[model samples]
Target: MNVFSALRAFRELLPVLRPEWRGMLWSYLIGTASALSLAGLTVLTAWAVGHAVVERTPPGPLWWVLVIGLVLVRAVLTWREMDVSHALAYRVLARLRMALFDAYARSVPGRRREHSGYAATVAMDDIEKLEFFYAHTVAQLGASLTLFLASLVSASVLLPEAGLVVLVGGLVVASSALYRARAARRLGEQEQRERSALSTRIVDALGALREVLAYGLAPRIIAETDAATARAAAIARRHELLSQLVTAIRELVITAVVIGIIAVSSSAAGVLAEGAQARLSPAELPALVALALAGVAAISDATATLTRLHPLVAGAERVATGIGRAPVVSVPERPRPLPTGPLGLRFRDVSFAYEGRRPTLTSWSVELAPGEHVGLVGPSGSGKSTVIALAARLWDPLAGTIELVTPDGTGIPVAELDDAALRDAVALVDQEAVLFHGTVRDNLLRGCAPRSDADLTAVLERVGAAAWIGLDDELGEGGVRLSGGQRARLCLARALVRRPRILLVDEVTASLDPATEQAICDVIAGFPGTVLVASHRAQTLARLDRLVDVTDITGVTGVVPAGRTGGA
Candidate 1:
């Protein structure tokens, strides 16, 4: 990306960072002082050497005092700088992660066709990489430049010839940025793509490791992963080689500048062979060379720092793409209040499609009054789940509005409801419900803030799961070791505890035994509000008050998948 464009991406993260500006201020201040102190040490050492030589004296008490004091100051400043910057970086990372998660939740179920694995990488690793930029790279670069400028000014005061060389060398290094500017940006973009692809493959492989092993597909997956890794490696190698090539040129330029300064200064010292030149002493030569050498070395620092950030610039670009994504479902500026008492839902002529695919739902419509239980059935891909998604407002209809109607005839657009209110009004239980890594109670109350032990137990009983998931029981990741039926029951209990106004269940009993399926169906039937379930089993559909054929509403049709026959 261009510098302007790369910086623009950084701007997207400001909303999450704005609140922590106070901590950033402290970090920057400490870093600046540290950098300046280090720079000052070099100058002071050179000045001391010059005094010692010109005066024909070994040293003085003050010389040791100056060196010791500068070293101590540098140490203290460096420590403080690191301490403050990390404090800010960690805080920013935490906030960024939370914001990314919230964005995903708001855009999923309906908008889930987008790159989920890529987003996961952003929330996990890409955001973490930004710590270098947010914490050290940004502030350290600023401080280093400031110190370089100050050092240049001091050099000019002492020896104008040397100072000009330093100034010109700095400009040359800065101009070299133009050489690889376009290529670097392209490489950065390519690297970002490869990294995201690699991350996606890793996430997908791990998520489906069981199936991969069962089907003996490990070789194919391994080959694919290896290919992605090789591609990423190639991109990284090309990028690094280019950066190193530039750095080499930069070092050459600095060397040339240093040589030029030495020759010019030496000639000047010679001109003192007679009149004014005679006053210039040979004793000052080492000090002048030392100062020039130190100044030249700063060029290496500048070049190295820029090269280090080249990769991150690309990572930041990807993160910006994610953070900049416009959510498929938009929340209203002023959300309407939720319906009072039980909630009645209506979908009027809704239509939607995922990018290039044909319309998944075309001018579809449905209505469910409060306290009614409706089941959706049709062949696969007939948009059964889409209906439930619309009611939950996961995505807005392309052609119509999903509304919540009160008894008094008030129509509240689902989008107009507050997020918390919307969440409280709808609960979704899928066939493969995600159970997080935590205690049973933690997974049960993932986001419900006002949950109590009594409420938890009651919910468990409602789902016929009181026997398996005790408050302190360890369920492990994704509820490992739990029977399929137990897992379903826990998920069901989780949904039941929410007490939502509308419950959307997507084939929750597709793989369950008859007893477990009936038990789950009973729990859902007893729910006191609107319930919309999409299932292939005739038995499950028959349990509802009525069945709505997705084919009739979505203008698409299909035969039910054969696997669901056992449940019915």
Candidate 2:
């Protein structure tokens, strides 16, 4: 997208800030007042010099009083303008941050895989750059134009030739902003990409620091990061050089405008028609030049602002598209309550296909009765995990309905249930279940229903987790402070703390030893809840009430293991 369109998209992404608009208006007014005061000061100083040199008299007390009063007002308005604009910018940035977070929260683990650090850069760094656009660009541009117009009008009434010079100079400065803009946008986009890529690599390396050290890949990773940084810096250097060229062109145009004004005032051109009187007297020549410079300077500042904002269009488009992305699974406008009792999930002829992957299920139908402990079994890549995910409502099936049935046989579509209610009714503990950075108590609670320490302790003990860690004990990232088995147990305990009625487990025994897996199975066996576990291990499935071969559900002939039965 072009710069203007990108800017429009970014503006649309902002929360409706009626109050900020009002603040912007005030800021614009104060800023214009400040500019006019400075311009007026410049003109008055020139006029006073002229008066002293030509009229040979001390300046009157009124002129001094007016100058002093304007200086004080300018100082106050300058500070107030900065304060209001920056405060408004920060408030908008904060709102934008929240909006971005909410958007990601709704659409995350999105159909397309995006690096977490890249997303973080968009939400954090990209949004931060917009502060200058919001605070200094819009309101300041308006103030600049107002001052320019005021000066233009005043100068025109004094000397039409000088007014013409100001208009031409303004246009010239403004045109420089559009020059080579396509190149600027390309560089900006490349720079933005490299930065995000660098961030992603850094985050990935940090996340896998253990692996890096174990495999001795630190040097390679560091070298790659340095190369990425160098590429970004090279692009930035080119961008700076182009900007300098634009600045040089703009300065040349301003100098030409000044020289043109001086020539006209000195009658060197003598191009005016006969009987057309000069508007400016000889003594007022310098003041006229000063006024014209003020007007041109205002226009120059505006052009400079646009030039800087041009490089941010790529970042703007990203943040806007990210925030505007619709969630793949939409929430219900008016949710229907799930049935009251042990929750039983039913998938009715569901079909699902991941992006760029072959269809995993077609016309797949399955049923888990209330309090039924069912295991999903099949060969690897036979859609076992897919069934668990469908049950959890991570992404809605491309076709068909998944419902929760009550003990009394009432069926409520999972899609129609409120997000909170569905989460309360169901919990999943997959092999990848994560323990966030916090104390054990924080991990257990996680803003689920409030429970006392004794209650948390009891659930931990049930999951065989209480023996190791206390409620207040801290857990590092992903529970790296603990072993894999320990992490799994703590994760299971964390899920159990929610006391969900329907538990979905996906390959919870895939990597665990026989002892740890049996302990987890024992916890599942004793728990009086509807459980659906997906596993290939015969021993793990042997404990469940029955095993539903996923290959049979999908009608994939060779996908099922040899000698596998329909149900175990």
Candidate 3:
């Protein structure tokens, strides 16, 4: 990306953190004060040295008091500035992290299986790299510019020629950033991609550890990860090398400016020029040199900060894009309230297609009246899950309206209905309904208000899980401690406990034993709420009030290969 685009990407992150502007402002002020104090100290010390050595006159008692006081004050301000700036950076990072998570939660699963590893890197690693940008860039740059200008004014007041030298040198140092700006940004982007790719592979391998070990693919994954790491390292090395070259050049320019300032100050003192009038005394020569050096050094530091931004540009872009991504599902400007009474689901000519693929549901239409039990039987990938997703409002349909029909026949479009109301009305229990790593009660009551043990016990008993598992029982990651059938029972219980008006089940019993499947089906059969089950099993389909053969409706063969016993 070009300079404007790179900067624009970084700028995008500011709004998410705008609420923390107070903290940022304090950080900036504290940091600026700290920088200015240090610069002032340098000038004061140079003045003392110049007067003492050149004129055999030591600084007065007032100068001693100012120097000693500044020293102590500078120490405290440095600590405070660091503390505030770091705190501000961390706060902003925390907010940014949450924003990224919110974005991912919305857009992911919609993107199918993209690089999960890359996402992780953005969330964790890439965000960490942004600390320098937040803590050091904006405030420090302001402080540097202010100091540079202050020094320039001081130098010019002392001697106009000295001021001119300072100005020219400052401009040269600042302009160095424009040199190879594109190269720095490109290398930074390259480094970011390589690192993210490497993280992706490593995370992928770790996640599929079972498959890797079972298939003896460890070596292959290792080789691939090693290669990715090497490539990333090489890119980083090149990036650093380029940075060093820039730094060297900048230092060379600063050195030249300092030399020029010393030469000019000498002439102003009438030492180098035979007939030149003395514009500055010999006692003030070191002070003039110090002012010029410090002024340009401030700008030099700012330039260095800009140069460092190149490494961060790519990561900033990723983070910005990730956090700035629009939600797949939009919240309505004026959400309509769900009509009171029994709620029925209706999908009228709904159409949706995934990215780079055929339409999953083409002009699809389905309806379920209150308390009606319907089963959708289709081939795998035959849009069964897509229908469930649309009904759940995970993603809006590309075309056509899906609404909830009220008792009075008022159809409230899902798009227009309040999200929380919809979620309360509809609960989905998919095949992979995961139990988080927590106590059973914690997972059961997650995000829920409150419930008594009696109420909890009643819900767990509905799915035949109360007998074995206590409310406080621990469930490992994905509830690995439980058998598939047991996990299914608990998952079903969790959904039922919500008392959702409309329950959407997606092959929840497909992998269960016949007995477990029957028990789970019994819970659904007993539920008074509206039910929609998508299953391939004959027994599972047989229990439903009615069945809709997807192929018959759409004139497309079943996407899932199953012995369809025909629609009920």
Candidate 4:
């Protein structure tokens, strides 16, 4: 993304950050005070030194008192500035994380194929990088500009020649930014990409650590991670080097300005002193030198900070890209209300294909009335799972609509219903239904509202998994200890608790034993709504009310009736 686009994305956080605006304002105020006070102290100390040297007299206690007081105030303001700004930034980070989560929940099983690892990286690491903005950008910009202006005005009052030189020198340092800004921006972009890739690889490796260990592929994963890290480091170093170069050039400009200002100020002071019939006094020498140096140094310091921040500013650009990514599916503004009770489903001419791929479905259609069970069986790569996904509206079909029907025959498009209503209307229990790293109760409650212990017990019993696990049993991450059948039953129990209007089971029974499979099928048979099963087992297919032959229709394949005997 271009700088403007990145900036626009950064501005999006303002709404969530509205509560922090007061804190941010205070931070900026404190920061400005701190910077100006420090500048003031520099000039005052210089003046005191010059006076003491020229007259051979020590500074009065009041002079020391003023300098010390300025120092104390500067320190206090600096502390306040960081404390308030960082507090505000962290709050914004939390808000951004919550927003991204909400976006994901609304857009999953996700519109396009995305890696779990990459999504995890976004949720964890990418959002953390945004702290740079909240902590530094707004307050620093305010503080830097405020100090520069204050210093410039002070120098002008001290001596016009000194002020002019400082102004010209500040402009020259700013000009260095123009020369290096483009290169820094480009390096920043490269560095951001490398960082993101490194994050993705690290997350992926960690998540698959078991697989790597099991297959003894640890060396390969390690090598890949090392390579990604190396690439990231190289890009980051380039960015750092460019920033240092900018700083050096800025310092060079400041040195030149200091020399010019001293030369002109000395000449002006001598000319004035001689005309006034007084020899040039040593007392004023250091004062003019300090005035010339102080303001110019402030400009250079501000310039250096801006240059150092260039990388972070660029990092924000990458974060903006993630935030600005378009949602795979567009949610309707005004959702259509779903059927009040158990509903039928129909797919009319529904067709879809992945981007840059041939169509998977074309002019295909199917219907299941309320409480009617249907089975969709297909060969590998056939659209059995795709059909189920489309019905769930994970992705909008490129053609036609999927509808839920009321008893009165009113049809509601799944896309038009609010996500909660649609979720209530259909449940998808896939083969890899993940159980989080928590108790069984936590995983089960995900399907519906939080349930009492009795409710959990009842669902577990109904799904025939209560005998194996309890509400308090830890599932470990991804249900590590649960066998295939146990995990499947637990997932089913989760779906059963919701009592959705339609249940879409995708090859969930494929890995279960005969007894476990029978138990799961019995639970499905007892459900009050439509049950659509995608499976290859004849026994599972035969249990359904009717068979839909996906092979006969475009975009629907691997489907056929279970012949009599049904046992395969």
Clashes of each: 3, 0, 4, 5
Model 3 local distance difference test score: 0.82
* Model 1 RMSD in angstroms: 4.4
Q: Rank the candidates by lDDT, best first.
A: 3, 2, 1, 4
RMSD list, candidates in order: 4.4, 4.1, 3.4, 4.0
For all candidates in order, the CA lDDT equals 0.75, 0.81, 0.82, 0.75
Write the residue-wise lDDT of candidate 3 on 49-72 in tens digits. 988998888899999899988899
Candidate 1 lDDT score at position 149: 73
Candidate 4 achieves a global lDDT of 0.75
lDDT of 4 by residue, 216-251 (tens): 988987898888788878988888887787778877
Higher-scoring candidate on TM-score, 3 or 4: 3
Instruction: Report how far residue 54 has shifted in candidate 1, in Å.
Output: 3.7
Cα distance off (Å), candidate 3, residue 48: 1.3
Candidate 1 structure quality by residue, lDDT tens digits, 46-87: 667766766667657887787788899989988877788878
Candidate 1 CA-lDDT value: 0.75
Worst 10 residues of 3 by lDDT: 559-568
Look at candidate 2 and give me any clashing residue pairs. Answer: none
